[model samples]
Structures are given as structure tokens and as C-alpha cells.
Target: MSKRTTLQIATYGIVCLAILLVPSFMDDAFILNKYARYLVLGILALALSLSWGYAGILNLGQAASFGLGSYCMAMALKLRTVPVHTGKTGLPDFMVWNNVETLPWFWEPFYSLTFAIFAGVAVPVAFAMLLGSFIFRGRVTGVYVAIITLAALVVVNLLIIDQQRYSGGFNGITDLAQLELFGLTFDAYSSSSYYLIAISLTVCLFFALAVTKSKAGLILQAIRDHEERVRYFGYDVARFKTFAFAVSAGIAGVAGMLYTIVMEFASPTFLDVQLSLSVVIWCAVGGRQSLLGAALGAIIVTGMQGALSESEIFLESWTLIMGFVFVMIVLFLPKGLAGAIESLVDRIIPEDHAVQVKSRAAASRRGVENEAGSP
Candidate 1:
């Protein structure tokens, strides 16, 4: 492997090791739970990086998939909550208060934990597929895509809030039971829950890394840089875009489910426009082109946000402070923190090694171009 590739692998290894070791050093359940949520947000950032960074498809409504998964898991866990929390008919308290006589037909399947878990991922993938079919196949691109996605998110958020009887309105679903699997309980405040989030984020980060290194991933990036050229090269641009979008949605869905577990509730705010925008900022701060960078960006930003919000002096100005930080980063580090670090590392590497890596990259680009130009 090249020096650059080796460095990347080492970076990933060190980061993963640090994450796995966090629980070992932190014994406070509250702190661990907070970190777990940050990790879950990291997964969401990774999802955005996969689509926006790699595929060049900026989905402003990414939280829709996340919120869907959150509600799906919340529904299952709500059913498992203590009987006292439910109505006489064993319906969610919100549904009971809204006078839901029987569980909606759509909600029946969520009673099965297995099905709920499956749906948490499946539903988002399906939604992405459906939306992508129209957005991509219709040849939507650039800011138009962003507008459509944002509009879709608003619609979904409104629907959830309007259908309070079914969706629990703006209040969302709460009184969730601890997640039970294989006879083990995952309490929100327990170490086990933190591990679950960490493990899930690790799996997602690696999975995304693998995807970006695959043949299809190369084509996706090529399309991102030159969509027309890729289409001329006989590649189905729409298919690749849709596939990336769907994969992003699936990962976001998984993050959402984990969020539900950590927070012990599902709130419409999970689908809020602000949350989706925050995700984009996380990806930008971390270096969208790098999965590990994006994930770490999310974790760091979220941790800072939590700390700032808790500080008596900064509590009221934390949002503005974060905005200023983002602007500064954009101005000074256009490629983001990851890119800046990579540049520093490149300067420290032997000149010969750097030249070799650049030559190989140029050769690879030529090879791709030559292949595309061939009959």
C-alpha cells in the first residue's frame, strides 16, 4: 500500500481503538450515555458523507429517514413499556389520550421487536429508493435537489405533527422500555447501551469506507465530478446515485434507531429542519470526503455543543458561537479539519514518497479516463 493509504488505515485504527476504550475510562453512566448519543450522531454524519461527500448528492432532508427509524423503534419499545404507562387497551399513552380505540393497522407489525428492527432500516431504504427514483431518474441536480429534499422533510415533519393521534404529534413517542435482545437489557444509562452505539458506529464507519473504496464507489465519484462524462461513458448515472442515496438512508436509519435507544424516546425534533442542517454542518467541519473525518467531526461538535450548552456563561450564546466557529473553519480550512491534517502529514512525509503517491494517483486517473474513452 501507498504511504497515504497506510496513514489512513492507522488513523482509522487509532480512532476506533480510542472509541472502544472510552467506556473503560468513563464509569459515569450519565457521561457514557451522553457519549453514546454523540457516537450515534457520528453515524448520521457518516451517512451524510457517503451521499453528499462521495455521491455529490446533498440531501437536506436526511433527518427524515432518521426520524422514521426513531419512531419505528420507539413504537416497538413503547409497546414493551410497563402496562401502567399505556391505556386500558394497551395503546401508547398519547394514542390513548387521542382516543385511539385500537392500534392502527400500520402499527400492528411494530409489536414484533424483530419486525420493528427490520423496519427501522428497511423503511428508510425504501423511502430513499422511492424518492431517489423520482429525483434522480428525473435528472434533478444541484440546489434543486436540496430544495426538493428540504421541502420533503418539511412535509414529513408536518405530517407527523398533524397526525398526533397516530404519531404523537410534536410530543413524539416516550415511555419506552429498555431494549431487550438475547436476554440482555440495554438500558439508556448503562454501559451496554454505550457499547452498542460504539459498535454500531464502528461497523457503519468501516462499511462506508469499504463502499468508497469499491469499484462502484469510484464510478460514483466520477459521476459526482463529471456526471455528463460518466453518462457518456455508458454508465447508468441515475442507478448509481440512487444506490448511494439509499445506502445513506439505511445508515441514517440505523443511527436513528440507536438514538431512540440512547434517549429512550422518539421526538419529532429528530426530523426537524434544524437537525438536518446541523448534520450538514458536522460533515462540513469534519471533511465530508472522508468518512472517519465526518464521524469525528460530529462527535467533537456534539460534545462541544453539550459542554457549551451546559456552561452558565455560554448557554445562551452557544449556537451563535458554534456558527462563528463554522464560518472560521470554512474560511481557513475549506477542505475541513481532516483535509488540513492530511496536508500537514503530507508535508512531513518524505518528498519521494509524496511524489510516488501523486504519480500513482495521476496514473489511476489516466487509466479511468482511458477506459471511459475506449470503444
Candidate 2:
């Protein structure tokens, strides 16, 4: 690997090591849990970076996929608390409140932790694939894609709210039990949960980086820059878009699952349009094109939220602050924070070798000039 690549890898390794060691350094459970939440949000930002930055797909419904995964995990935990093999006994509280005498057929498979896990990833991917096939094939692009995705998020939220029996309506799925993974109990707010989230976030980041570096990554970038040119080059642009969209949605779903573990609940708020748009803002603030930027952006936003939440007087000002941050980043720091940092470093690293280059050029010009003057 090149020196730059090696340095980057080493830096990332050090950061991961530090994060892993956080349990040893911080005894505060609340702070530890907050970091876990940060990791989950970072995963969402990473998803946005992959799709919007590299693939040029501004997905506005990522939160829907995320909510689906969260609901899957939350429901699974809820299932574990109720009686087993008793008809409708394992039904979630909201279902009982809604007079759902029988468990929904779809919720049946999610009773298994493995099934919930699969559903978390698969459902979002399948949905994205279905939508992409139609949208990309029809040559939909730009704002139209964003609008459609936004519409999807709104529709999904409405659907979930309407299905009070199964979805918990606006109250959402809550009072989740600790997760059981292969006979191991994963208690929410536990140190182990923090470690799990960190590991998952790292894995997602690595996978996203791999995807962006692969051959399909090249084609995706091409499509982003010139879809027609890619199509004319005999590439099935639609397939590529669908693939990227599916992968991104899968990543978002994973984030959603982790987030449910952090918050111990799943609600329509998870699928809110604001949630989806917040991710876009995160990606933009972090540098939409840089994975590192995306992660940083998430951390920054989450940290700010935590800070603001502590101040009752400033609670209402948080949104305004976020808006200001977004506008400032877009106007001045086009490359996002990571991009800006890189530019600054490049500027600071003076090109001493330029002296030799300039000397050679000047000598060559002087030699020619001297010869011409003598003649």
C-alpha cells in the first residue's frame, strides 16, 4: 500500500483501539451508552455517504429502512418477554391494546432472533431493489428521485401509524426486553452493548469502503457523473443504481437495528422525514463524498444534540444551530470537514521539491535565451 493509505489505516486502527478501550477509561454508564448511540448514527451517516457521495443517489427514505430494522429488532425483543406457543400471547403490548386477537402473519417469522436479523437487512434491500428498478428504468433522476424517496418515507410513516394493531400506531413499539443472541443476553445500556455497536459500526465502515473501491464502485461513480454516458457505454445503469440503493438500504437497516438497542424502543419517529433529512445534513456536513467526513458529521451532530439537550433554555435553538451549521458548511467547506482538513494539510506541507523543479525550468529557459542573444 502507498504511504498515504498505510497512514490512514494506522490512524483508523488507533481510533478504533481507543474507542474499544473507552470502557476502561469511563465508568459512567450514561456516557458509554451515548457513545453507542453515536456509533449507530455514524452508521447511518456512512450509509448516506455511500449512496449520496459515491453513487450520487440522494435517498430521502433511509429512515424508513432504518425504522423497519429497528421495529424488527424491537419486536423480537418484545416477543421474548411474552408466553411461548400460546396463541397471540407473544403479541406485543400495542397489539393487545389494539384488540389484535391473533399475531400478524408477518410478525410470526420475527419471533426468532435470527429471523428478525434477516428481516432487518433483507426487507430494506428488497424494498430498495423494487423501487430502484422502477425509478432507474424510467430515467428518473435528481430532485425527482429525492421527492419520490421523501414521499415513500411519509407514506411509510402513515402506514405504520394506521396499522395500530401491528405497528403500535404513534406510540410505537417500546418497553423492549434485553436482546438474546444465540443464548447470550445482550442487555441494553450494558458495556457489552457498547462493544457490540462499535464492532458493528467498524464492520459496516469497512464493507462500505470495500464496495466503493470495487469495479462496481467505478461504474457507480461514472453513473453519478454521467448516467447517459454510462448507458451508452453498454452498462446497465439501472442495475448498478439498484445494487447501490439496496446496499445502502441494507446498511441503514443495520444502523436502525443497532439504534433500537441503544434507545430500547422503536417508533414512527424513527421513520420521520426529519430523521431521513438529518442524515442528508450529516452527510453534507461531513463531506458527502468522504466516508470519514460522514462519520465525523454524525458524531458532531449527535454531540451537539446531547449538549443542547442538557440546557433547557437552549433546547429550541438546536434546530436553528444545525441549520446554520449546514449552510456554513455548504457555502465555505464544500468538501466537508474531512475534505477541508485534507486541503489544509496539503497546503501546510510545503513543496520543497518545487525549488528544484523551478530551478531546472529556469536553467533551461536561460540556456535558450543566452544562445539566442549570442546569435
- What lDDT does the true structure give each of the candidates? 0.92, 0.84
TM-scores for all candidates: the values are 0.92, 0.88
Across residues 70-104, which tens digit of lDDT does each residue of candidate 2 receive? 98888888887754434344666667666778888
What is the alpha-carbon lDDT of model 2 when measured against the actual structure? Answer: 0.84
Clash pairs detected, candidate 2: none
| Cα distance off (Å), candidate 2, residue 167 | 0.8
Q: Worst ten-residue run, lDDT, model 2?
A: 82-91
> In model 1, which regions exceed 4 Å deviation?
85-89, 350-375
Clashes of 1: 0
